[model samples]
Target chain A: LAKTTQPISMDSYEGQEVNITCSHNNIATNDYITWYQQFPSQGPRFIIQGYKTKVTNEVASLFIPADRKSSTLSLPRVSLSDTAVYYCLVPNAGGTSYGKLTFGQGTILTVHP
Target chain B: EPEVTQTPSHQVTQMGQEVILRCVPISNHLYFYWYRQILGQKVEFLVSFYNNEISEKSEIFDDQFSVERPDGSNFTLKIRSTKLEDSAMYFCASSERSGLAGYNEQFFGPGTRLTVL
Candidate 1:
């Protein structure tokens, strides 16, 4: 499994864009970067995922560099309800250890009015 | 949207007693998983089940913990003897498939908060 590092916390204002970066220096070639969002007392929700380059969805966008060592989750025009803890995971999606998600101390994004 | 659902949103149990956490995953999902999060801590994987058997488990899932898909729709996690450390929010997740190249997005339930006293 690859280890990931992210900012402990981030502050954003309503209608502003927020970007959370994750560092996975040891990520494998086949590893795909997946992001999840969790509000207080709720389960984590899938946000976006990408292997390389940029992948955009209605909720968020993921940008992966050529090296695949790091990825960024960009949330556009954030709102107060968008405040949550965001996790960047590299799941063991294949082989004997398939579909086990290893979550880290994710970045807590606090949206201010 | 078809989402995973868990029963007994909150459970309070005494130490040395048995407790069962139940979940009903999305009807079409094939892979099931259990994870827990201690207050102010990161989420930790406990176990994963597929094909009526366990596919993988973490060290946190000890002998006291067991998983069963006793019926077509229900998946349960049983703790024979609960301890104080067992207190946490247990989450159930499921996915339609596995593998990096395929659709492996795991959808999680709201979670069951278990408190041991």
Candidate 2:
């Protein structure tokens, strides 16, 4: 499994856009970047995933450069309800390592009024 | 959309006692996983089950830990002997496919808070 590093915390205001970047310099060929959002006292929820370039969803957007060394999760017009810890994971696609996700400290986003 | 569900939202047990955590994955999902999060720590993967067998597990999933489907709709994780270190939030997740098979999205349940005395 490739290790990912992201900001420990971030502060954003309501109605503003927030972007959290994760760096995985040793990403494998079959590795895919997956982002999960975890609110206090709840389970982590899937936000967005991407292999390269850009992928957008109803909740957020994931951007991965061609190098695949890093990726960014962008949340638009954030709200206080969006405050949570975001985890960026890179799991191998095949073999035993498959389906085993190693989570990092995660970026805790704090939305304020 | 159907989501994963867990039972006994909270559990308190004594050290050396046994405990079973239950989960009901999404009806159509094929892959099931168990993860634990210690207070103020990152989520750690324990095991993943597919097709009635374990596909993979982490070092954290030692002999003390076991997973069973038991029936058609329920997946369970059992700890033979609980310890203080076992206190944490256990999360159950399910994916439509294995990571090798496709872009897998593992949906997670609210989690079971296990406290070992």
Candidate 3:
């Protein structure tokens, strides 16, 4: 699995846009970038996923550049409730590996008022 | 949205005793997994189950630990003899699988916090 490095923490004010970037310098072709958001006392939830370029969902957007070395997760109009730990994951390559995630020390996002 | 559910949201056990953590994954998902996070540490993978057998496991899942899908509806992890270090939050996850792609979005359950004394 490609190792991932992300900021330890970030801060944002309400109604501001927040962008968190994760670098996976050793990423392989078969690796896909997926993000998960985890709130206190709750399980991590899927936010968005992308192989390349840009993919957006109702909750967030993921942008992957051509080099595939790093990806950014963009959250629009953040609110205090958006404060949580965000994780970036790249699965190990195999035929039968169905989402066996190796989690890193996720980036903690604190949304301020 | 369909979600994974786990039993006994918190379990407190004595060291050297046995304990079991149970989970019911999303109804239609085929793959099951176990992960744990020590206090203030990153979540770590334990094991993955598919076709009623373990497909992969990490070094942390030593001989003292075992996983079983005893029946259709439940998956359980049993620790033969718990140690103090075994205390952590255990999370169960499941995902649907198909084709040659080795990945799927896994849905996690609210973890069971195991406290060993």
Candidate 4:
């Protein structure tokens, strides 16, 4: 499995946008970039995933550059309820990879009301 | 909007006691897995089960830890002898079948919090 690195913490104000980036220089050629948002005391929830370029969803957007070495998770108009730990996984959403989710120390997003 | 469900949301067991954590995966899913998260720590995979057998397991899953799909609807994790260090929130997840016969995008349940005292 490919390893991922991301910021440990990020601060954002309500109504502001927040972006967390992750680096996986050794990403496999078939690897996809996936992001999960986990609330305190709950399971990690699926956010968005992408192989390259950009992918958007109702909750967040994933921006992957041409290199595929890194990806960004963008949350728009953040709210205090959005405060949670976000994890960026290397190409690991529903494939032959199975559930080998080696979670990194996720980025804790603190939103000030 | 189907979801996986677990029984006994909270279990309090004494050290060296036997405990079983139960989970029911999504009906159509073909894969089952167990994961645990100690307090204030990241979730760790315990084991993955497919084709009525274990496909992979972590170091944490020792001989004391065993899993069984006793029936079509129930998947269980049994810890032969509980320890204080085993106190954690255990989660059950299931996923559809992937092309290579591996699990697909896994959906998790609320989790069963086991407190080993």
Candidate 5:
């Protein structure tokens, strides 16, 4: 697993779009960017993932540049319930990789009223 | 809406005592993992199990730590001799194996908070 850095906290309002950026300068070629959302007292939930370029899901979008040193998770139309810590992971995208997640200090997204 | 389930949301035991944390992974998922987080620290992986065998483990998974899938639906992490430093929130996760390619999303269960005295 590659080391990642993300914001300590972020504030947003309901109905707004929020972007959380994570930096992983040493990410390997085989690594893929993956994001997860975790609410209080709950396990982290998968949000989005991408190898390069852009990937969008019903919940969020992942934007990765050619360098892949960093990636951004875009959550549109955020709600108060979206208040949770978001984690960025560069999981080895292939070949015998299991869920050995090394969670960093996630970005806590606070969506207020 | 399938979810992994963990038992005894909270467990309190004395140091040197054996403790077992139980989890029921999603029915169809083939890969299972165990991770723990101290009160204010990041989550750390303990071990990963598949095909009823240990695939990978972290340095934290020392001699005292073990994982077992006793039945069809249950995956258990057992600490042979718990320690004060072992008190933490332990999480269980399962993922569906999709070939050898990457990008399999792991589904996690509500964690078990283990308190060692």
Candidate 6:
């Protein structure tokens, strides 16, 4: 498992773009950068995932640099409903680990009206 | 979208009592996992199951915790003896494939809030 570091909290307003960055200096070659979102009293939901470069989906985009030591989750046109805790994980996606997720404290994003 | 489902949105029990948490994973998912989160704390992985057997577990799983796929559609976690420390939200998740095949994106359930006194 690769340890990840992220901001404790971030604030954003409606219609604004929010970017959260995670640093995992010890990420492994077989590891993939994954992000999850959790609203109050709910389970973590998968947002986006990527191995390298950039990957975009209906909800968000993941940007991984060439070094892969860090990654960024970019959310466009944020709304109050988007307020949640965002987790950045570097899980070994090609080993015998069985895909168990290890979550950190995560970055709490609060969207204002 | 087919999502994982857990039973007993909330459960209250006494210390030393046993409790079973049940989950119905996505119909096509092959891998199942259990995770817990104490209030204001990070979510912690308890165990992972595949092919009706445990594939991995954290130190927290210990002897008190056990998992079973009693039938084709249901997966369960049993705590033989509950402690005050066991009070937390238990989340059940399922994945279509294991890490061995590369992509292993897991879908999570709403979670069971367990309160032990």
The list of candidate 5 runs beyond 4 A from truth reads B98-100
Q: How many clashing pairs per prediction, in order?
A: 0, 0, 0, 1, 1, 0
Comparing 1 and 4 by DockQ, which wins? 1
List TM-scores of chain B, every candidate: 0.96, 0.97, 0.96, 0.94, 0.96, 0.97
* lDDT accuracy of residue A44 in candidate 2: 93
Q: Poorest 10 consecutive residues of model 4 chain A by lDDT?
A: A91-100
What fraction of native interface contacts does model 1 preserve? Answer: 0.66
Docking class of 3: medium
Winner by TM-score between candidate 5 and candidate 2: 2
Q: TM-score for the first chain of model 4?
A: 0.92
Per-residue C-alpha lDDT of model 3 across residues A1-113, encoded as one tens digit per residue:
78999999999999999999999999988888989998887778889888899999999999999999999999999999999999999876555565678889999999999
Between prediction 4 and prediction 5, the one with superior TM-score is 5
For A14-71, candidate 5 gives per-residue lDDT tens digits of 9999999999999988887888888887788888788899999899988999999999
State the local distance difference test value for candidate 3: 0.90
Q: How much lDDT does candidate 1 score?
A: 0.92
Candidate that would win on DockQ: 6
Q: Point out the higher-scoring one by lDDT: 3 or 6.
A: 6
lDDT of 1 by residue, B26-53 (tens): 9998999999999889999999999999
Chain A TM-scores, candidates in order: 0.97, 0.97, 0.96, 0.92, 0.93, 0.97
* CAPRI level of candidate 6: medium
DockQ of each: 0.67, 0.68, 0.58, 0.41, 0.63, 0.77
* lDDT for each residue of candidate 5 in B1-117, tens digit (9 for 90 to 100): 999999989999999999999999999999999989888788788898999999889999999999999999999999999999999999999999732466548889999999999
lDDT of each: 0.92, 0.92, 0.90, 0.85, 0.88, 0.94
What's the residue-level lDDT of A113 in candidate 4?
Answer: 82
